[model samples]
Each structure stands twice: as structure tokens, then as C-alpha cells.
Target: MPDALADALYELIVATRILANEKVLDAFGHVSVRHPLDPQRYFIPRHRAPELAEISDLVELTLDSEPVRPTDFRLYSEKVIHGEIYKARPDVHAVCHHHAHAVLPYAISGQEIVPVFHLGAVMGKVQFWDQRDEFGDTNMLVVKPEEGASLARALGPHWTVLMRRHGATVAGTSLRELTFRTVFTCDNARLQSQAMAHGRVDALSPGEVKLTAAHQLRPPSTNRAWDYWVRQVEKAGLMPARAAAKGASTTAARAKKADAKRAPTKSARKNSVKSKRRR
Candidate 1:
């Protein structure tokens, strides 16, 4: 594999494991990264638990969410979630779909997820997409292109969108950023819930949201969190094969290089819009 592609796949696997370890994804959710060399394709693991994802488990699919080659491996039924978002948002190179426990109440209750703290600002303005709004409900899985496209339209230019009564999908300009947002978004939800139990929850003001997000979502902050999460995964003995072979020094070097290559541009950062009430 080319260095860029190999690094992307390696980080993708690491992101999957990190999210699983953090409980942002239990068994059903998935994480994917767009092809570094090809805009029309993306890579995600075949049907499996996020914790078990490895480099070999990845399968490339077109933006239409069709497999590039015939494979006996079962694909994710919601793979279209990743593909359609890629088609809709060129600035997004990574996507994560999860039904994390902390975010479930918001999804089920249609409550808005706002920045209750500084780190939570990374989530920007969370959007909402109800399948029933257009499809009038079925199994609730985004298995069809039209379904995924609807979700993508709801996502608009935001970094995260909640699927009503289902889960939330997060997009990022890089795999590390995706992982950072997924984990912290869950943390923010849990915090917000706890705060609500005490008294009125004061979410960050719009100016605070923009300022904090600009500061916290930088490469240095993301790198720090990524290193910490990778260590946690390593301690759990969940590191992917390639990452383990590369060792910490090489892994850190590659991470820096990947960040340099895939870091979000100014336009990409501006893509996150302020939160708007959705019903």
C-alpha cells in the first residue's frame, strides 16, 4: 500500500478501536475514511464490531456505497451513511456513526446537543435528521441511497447530525478529528444530562462556541488527544497489526505527517455553522 493510504487505513483502524474502547461505539456502529488518493471512494470495515476492526477487514466502496469488487464479506447495511456524506461534503474525509448511550436520550427525545463545555465546542452546531420526516419510518437503518442522502442534507455543513430515535453521525476533515469529536460529543452529552438533573443547563453562547471550537479543534489539541487514546487502546491490547508493528516512534511520526497532509483547511473549519433549533 502507498504510504498515505496505509497511514489512512491504519489510523482508521485505530479510530475504530479508540471509539469502541471509549464506549462511543459498542458493537453496531462504524467509522470510515475517504480514500486518500481517490475522491470517489472510501474505506470501511466489512460487517463486524468496531473493536475487532483491522487493516485486512477494510473494504473500499464507491460514493454510491457499492463495493469496488465482488466480495463474500458482508458489508455494513448503513454503509451508505458514509458514502452519501462524502458525496455531499467534499471537505469531510472521515465519518463516524454511533448510537452511544450518552447521545441516545437526545436522539430519542429530539433534544438539541449543545456545547455545555469548552471541549464540547468541537461538535459545533448539531443537526437533526428524522427518517420519518421523509421516509415515514421503516427498519430505521439508512440502507438506501435516498435515505442516506436525506440524512446528509440534514447534516448540511455541520460537523455532527443526530438521527432521530437512532443515533448521531459525525464528520471530520481527518480521522483523528472524527475520533476526537465522537468521543467528546458523547462526553458532552453525559455531562449535559448530569447538569440537567441539577438545574438549568447553560450551553455555551454562540460566540463561545465559535471561539472555543477554533482553539480546541486545532492539530495540537487533536494530536494530544489522539496520542492519549492510542495509548489507552494499546494498554487494552487492541492496537491494530500495522500500528503495533510500526511502534510508538514511527506511529507518532506518521501521525504528524498525516495531520500535515489532511489537516482541515480554513474553508473546512468555516463549514461548521451555528446551531439552529430543529424539530
Candidate 2:
């Protein structure tokens, strides 16, 4: 079995891929897990083909976006966006940022991740920064620390925020919960978009939203929702446990072959020596 960290990290990465494959994440996007030992830092898999990531590939970065790898100094260019979010929100241990087809209009629009449906109520009355200085038509704002700070203020206490014309953000106290926010926010937005397609939309009442919030404020229930979503990922075979297992076996076999090749051969030195002493 994988170590605790590896298991959890892979689970999160797999979940991110599932969302990406579902088209929740576009050409460029990310999900990060806060380091348990270091609150000021997090781990994220760097560039090149989102579909190809493994537990060991994730690199840790400081809030300033520096990686331990000297060659990886580039880090996640906009990693400060996530860093500031982690710093500002004590309740959040995971965050997801990605683009969505239906969310694009809402991202750029004056609209917020409002409680348009029951699922959205979990976000605790969503809000938006509405063209913040740092993120004008972009998903990131790590160009400057002050600008990133401004974005943090806009994120506020809500679990969801829409960066106009860029994308959406979701934070949760746990990896599962954050992923739940990430997954459900898109779902709720799509549903709202569909409903609004009729032109005459019936917005959820404040009282109704509040009632939903009361029931889903925390769980017993929301946790179950998060777990169920993970199972759904498994059921759809996107988790692909078999693939993961096969990959592991293949890796082990390659390592064994490498070790055998590197092993000292009794005749190896004789094979390379001069006839004078090698025999």
C-alpha cells in the first residue's frame, strides 16, 4: 500500500484528472493540497500534459512560488494566487481553480457563484471580486504580492469565487471537501445556466437558500456527498484502479531489471581485464 501522503496525494490528483477529463479544467489550470507540516506552502504538479502526473511528480512550493528544485525555479508562475488563498483562509486545506464552458459566461458576468440551487448553498452565500486588479481576464495574479493580497481580500470567507472572464475558485477545509466544492460549483452553475436559458429565471429565495445552508452548513451530509462523488468517479472507471495497479507493477519490474543490470558480475572484471591477471 502507498504511504498515507502518497495515497492522499494520488487520490487528489486522480480526482483532479477526473475533473479535467470531464472538461472542468481547460488548457491550463491547477489543484493544490496544503502541506500538513508547513501551512505556508503547498504541493502542485508542474507543467507539461496534465494527464501525465504521479504522486512523486508533485513539487512543493513556497507562498512566494519557489521550488526546492534549482532547475524548477520557474515553479508555478502564478502559485502565489494559491499561496495567498491558503494563507488567507485558515479553514481551507485544498483548492481547485479551473475553467468551465458554462462557467465562462458567469465568470465574466456580474453574477457570482450565487445559491442558484441546493448544491450551491454549501458555499455559504458565494460572492465575486468583479474584475479585480490582478485578475483582469485571467485566472492568476501572482505578478505582484500586493495584487495577490487584493485577490485574497476578495475571496473573503466564502468557499467559492468567480474571477470574471477567467475562471472559478473553491476552497474547503479538507481535500475531499474542497474537491466537492470544485465539482459541485460547476454542476450548480451548469444547471443554473440551463435554467436561465429560458430567459426568465427563478432565482432561489434567500430563505430557501438559508434553509439549504442550514441542512448542508456542514455534514454528516456534505461529507457523504463528497464520498459519494468519489465513488462515482470510481464507478465510471476514471479512477482506474486497475490501471494504477498495472503501472505500479510495470515500474517495479523496470526497477528490478535495472538493479540486475547494475549488479556486480563475477566475470565482469575478467571480461574487461588484460590477459596478464584477469584469468
Model 1 spans > 4 angstroms off: 242-279
Predicted candidate 2 versus true structure: per-residue lDDT over 76-122, tens digit per residue: 45566677888788778887776677677887776654657787766
TM-score of each: 0.86, 0.74
Cα misplacement distance, residue 244 of candidate 2 (Å): 6.1
Per-model clash counts, in order, read 0, 2
- 105-155: candidate 1 lDDT, tens digit per residue: 999999888899999999989999999989884898988889999999999
TM accuracy, model 1:
0.86
Candidate 1: C-alpha RMSD after superposition: 9.2
Q: For candidate 1, give the lDDT of residue 138.
A: 82
- The 10-residue segment of model 2 with minimum total lDDT is 270-279
What are the root-mean-square deviations of the candidates from the true structure over C-alphas?
9.2, 12.0
Local distance difference test scores for all models? 0.84, 0.63
